[model samples]
Target: MASNKFKIILWSVGILMLIFLGFFLYQLTQSESVNSIMILLMLLLGLILGGVIAFLASKKLVSEPAVITESSHTIAESMRKVFKVVSAEGHFNEIYNYEETTKLFNFIPSKKKALVIVQAKVLVGYDFEKFKWEVDEQNRKVKLLNFPAPEILSTETDYKYYNIEEQFFNLFSKDDLAKVQQNGKQQVIEAAKKSHLPEVAAEQMRTLLTELLAGKNFLLENPAKISETKNLIDYRNMNNSR
Candidate 1:
């Protein structure tokens, strides 16, 4: 906003300067005084030099540092939208086999046995609702305050049970199979986390921000500079050590 105001003032001054120069040139052209044409030419040359100086002065003023504050709320909201914009997924499968046998009575008994197989996948990356950032407009830079670490966002599983032999005393219920499916889904999520799928998503976000801000003349400040801080911080807290 200040930049816009500065430009308006500069251009206003420039236009007035040009108008005065034009008026003087007109009057000189009508003059019958000695060396009138020569004087007019010199005035035109002086006007060119003055105009150049004025343009440079305006540029210098515009470039001067001004405090531009961007709130955490604004950045966080925008980043949240972009966070859900694209998501990364990790695929995994685990072969889980379980056998359980149940016998009834001491000497005469029928046995119940079953075989199970499970496959699962995990979704990893930003959820968008949890986003945080800080901006320093004066420096034309932004800092990622807090971001979701690599984690399993969601999981899907498929399972099959076969080769079952059950007696009246022993049975496998739907509840039992449901428990196995849930376990399989959890295992897949843990595996995905260990594989650093979330880290891959984080890198993607970094690239996204870099590209997003490039045209805006904004830079993403390095995260390593404040590696110690676990949350978002004010721009003043940043140090030169980075």
Candidate 2:
């Protein structure tokens, strides 16, 4: 590549010299010749000097570093044969009343309670690691057997406390905060189990695979056994609790 670029630059210099010579001769012929020989020598010297400057400028322009807008740094990476695809997501917002009691003596009891507000999101999808399939490219046949089951992929929960009440003997402890948060998160998970998020994600996955295989005209041999993921996670029915 460097050799080719050098040859191109040499050809450019030769062409420039020819153009300057032709122009100088044309102008000399049109005007009266007082010192034509001296003018010719001077023109030759100027052409060489100008061509050298142009060549150096072109080289400088080509050698300048490329401009970068984003210098992104990679922190972590991993290789995976199959990745879990989240096809559907749902949000569940509910208020949970966390109540607890502690026994100070045989008959006396200390009470503590808080109105816990639960806000959470549930993501449902299929893990491709469990997927089973068979493909025949020769006969244009695709058999999709035991498909990956759509399950609760992940969940995010946030809690807020309101109207917290407790006696001096049964004030909030370190375990109380963790216990309330766990209880609120569990409620959201249980609610997601009854929703239709899993079913919707399964349907979306089916459509995606069908469209992908349509281009190659691969007939789905086993379409009956594909939709097996039970419906779970419904956003509409995620109602607030007291």
Candidate 3:
């Protein structure tokens, strides 16, 4: 939509310039005294040339920053995938894959390149609470400060707690864990230990473990599912307390 509007504005400006040029040409032809009219025509031609040069220069100036911004975004996204691999658990390594693509535009005659970046994220595991926590924390901090929040240790800890409790009450399900028995118990233990969950949040996960072991199913199935549940519980509790 914005691109369409910009195109319309550009076309309108060009049309107005052409109309002005036509009027100047008509005035030059109709005048009986050719000297003043010739001079006026030369001035009008200079103005048109000046306007075109200014338009091209402005387009180059505007396009450079947008190209740089898109390049930076692409680089940042690449860094994220590289870091995720370096830090991810074996469970994640086994389950998922990452890919990215960029759309390039050459808006001008120069070798200047503008990009539109798109990242594709696919999750294969049933347990995506950890990923959700990281995303939510980033979003929350960004919202609070109106800036990209740095992933410092303290902020990461907070996110871990939030996501773990969030996942425990939400994503763990009997069917999901049915295949993860004593054979895979070691893997599960290692994953839980290496996870970024806080102590309190880890303790809460014990109840989920118990339910899974006993072959009971939770009504909720994901972090988003748990968040909805939390909202409903909060609403009901608030009403009841009153």
Candidate 4:
């Protein structure tokens, strides 16, 4: 907006200068006694005034003051630290079982069965290490420009195998236990994601930024250009689907 206003002023001044020049030229042609030196002096005055206007416009709208730049850098540096903005804990329990049997040439078959009880706890939140932002010095506002989507930060699983009912036929292998634990962790993560953890984390971050900037005499712009976590989640899902 500031730039647009500056452009308008620049064009208006240019057009006014052209009109003044044209009038001066016409007057010089019509009056033989019109002093050439006076006309040059008037044009120089107009040029100097126009230059001043241009300089003021550029200074006010095009360039950021050093103090503003310093403030922005200070905020950026402070935000570089990792923030565990919000966390959601999820508990998941799943049953893992498989059966196998061997068949002989004609008839008799032996079967095996194995089962495991798997449980896990998952933690999900935003790591502010990837958070991004910009300072709108012209507007005296701090803007959250971009940030990483919420994700499952960590998963811890505890699982145990049930005693085999038929040891000869169904036995749990090391790979089977590993797969069960992994599946439990994945389920917990998915459950946590479905909750409102991301939105909570975003709101926490917004509050933190507001407080931080307030101390520096800067105001945080609400409904930041692209910082809302709800929108971010939708965007991330859309991108992943693609």
Candidate 5:
């Protein structure tokens, strides 16, 4: 909007300058004693004023500040409407080696081994149901008393069997294949976790909340650790102390 307004101002200024130049030419024709220096000076003044207007037009419209009049509950409710916020996507190529252990006194190695190449897409996101927060208009902040940790929201996996060596005595069964599939999925999840997917997702969420509260000029703060098992401690007293 601001850019469009500035563009309009620039075109208007250009047209006005052209008109002024045409008028100066007409004055040149009308009077031989007309001071060309004075006319140029006047045009310079007009250009300066036009530049000022253009600069003002390019500025942000501060008349309507983002003042969040809605209650914290309302904001939270609106956020819930967003449901599962998938912030990052990770494509993983993992090799999961699945083997059945020869459990002879728990000291035997599995002679049967199958190399499973797993290609998976992992979605990293937040569960808003676990989101705990409070909007403190006092501090101009939406304090995430309990910011939900990024988790593997979903994992889609495709497995390709590479080297399948099964002993005649301990052959692969349905249960073994199931274990392989599960392990392959787990490998993809682990790979996603080990990558920067969670960090990227967290940064994205922070950016999102920051923009959402930009109108209010509010900060997004996560004081409590989402990895902790305990509930977010009542932070009102803490904030009060601060």
Candidate 6:
């Protein structure tokens, strides 16, 4: 609406300026004196002032929000109701893998259409870690993965271990890092109990969750254990293995 008003104001200003120019031209042709120049200057000043006023008026109109009706409210409610109807029911589980030292939660909805992995970590001293959500759709199924950070492997070490401490330390201060670890641990327990995930998956999830939430540093800093869980396998590999 504001955009339309601006256009109208622009058009009005243009028309008024054109009208003033035409009058000024007539004066110049009819009279040849200093008074004619002054008249033309006055016309220019009036056009400038008018343009400014019109621009301000248009801005004022555009900045205001539009009013909504009861009908719009009803439409929004109807859409929400439809969404609830179509949404499927799924199961959730928390898994901890000893090898990976990570915790993860798996959610399986009634639709059997998507696999979602939610990873939550703590950032520095902040109460919450950045959450990342990734969704992969395959064979009419959607796989969603959400984690604080992307999985990192140590190239120097033969055994690939997820260095939770190193990762968190890199992002946060020492004090903040400690808090993040504590939160990560709590989150793992919550995800496990809440999701009621499978035992195998829950174990791996717990490992990672504990490392992230433990409030302490990892045990083996150099020769870190590698991640070899089936869940860690690429999506395509998961399908092929199945």
Best model number under lDDT? 2
Q: Write the per-residue lDDT of candidate 3 for residues 59-154, one digit (tens) a residue.
A: 654543444334333343333222211111222212111122233343422221112111211111112223232223322321111111111111
Task: Assess the local accuracy of residue 214 in candidate 1 as a C-alpha lDDT between 0 and 100.
Answer: 77
By TM-score, who's the top model here?
2
User: lDDT tens digits, residues 43-141, model 5?
Assistant: 778778877876776564434666777555434333325476888888888988876658545675557899999988877777677787898889888
lDDT of 1 by residue, 180-229 (tens): 56665556555665675655566666676677877799998875432232
Better by TM-score, candidate 3 or 1 = 1
Give the backbone clash total of model 4: 2
Alpha-carbon TM-score of each model against the true structure: 0.50, 0.60, 0.25, 0.48, 0.52, 0.24
Note the residue pairs that clash in candidate 3: none
Query: On residues 112-215, what C-alpha lDDT tens digit does candidate 2 reach at each position?
Result: 99999899888877777777899998888888777756767677777888999999988998888988888888788777777777777878888777877887
Write model 4 residue lDDT over 1-105, tens digit each, in one string.
Answer: 878887788889788888878788787777666477677677878788877878787777875656533333334334343555444445667676656576655
Ranking by lDDT: 2, 5, 4, 1, 6, 3
Report the CA-based lDDT of candidate 3 relative to the real structure. 0.34
TM-score of 5: 0.52
**When superposed on Cα atoms, how far off is each prediction in RMSD?**
32.5, 22.3, 23.8, 31.3, 26.4, 23.6
Name the candidate, 4 or 6, with the larger lDDT value. 4
Position 9, candidate 6: lDDT: 63
Residue 233's lDDT in candidate 6: 17
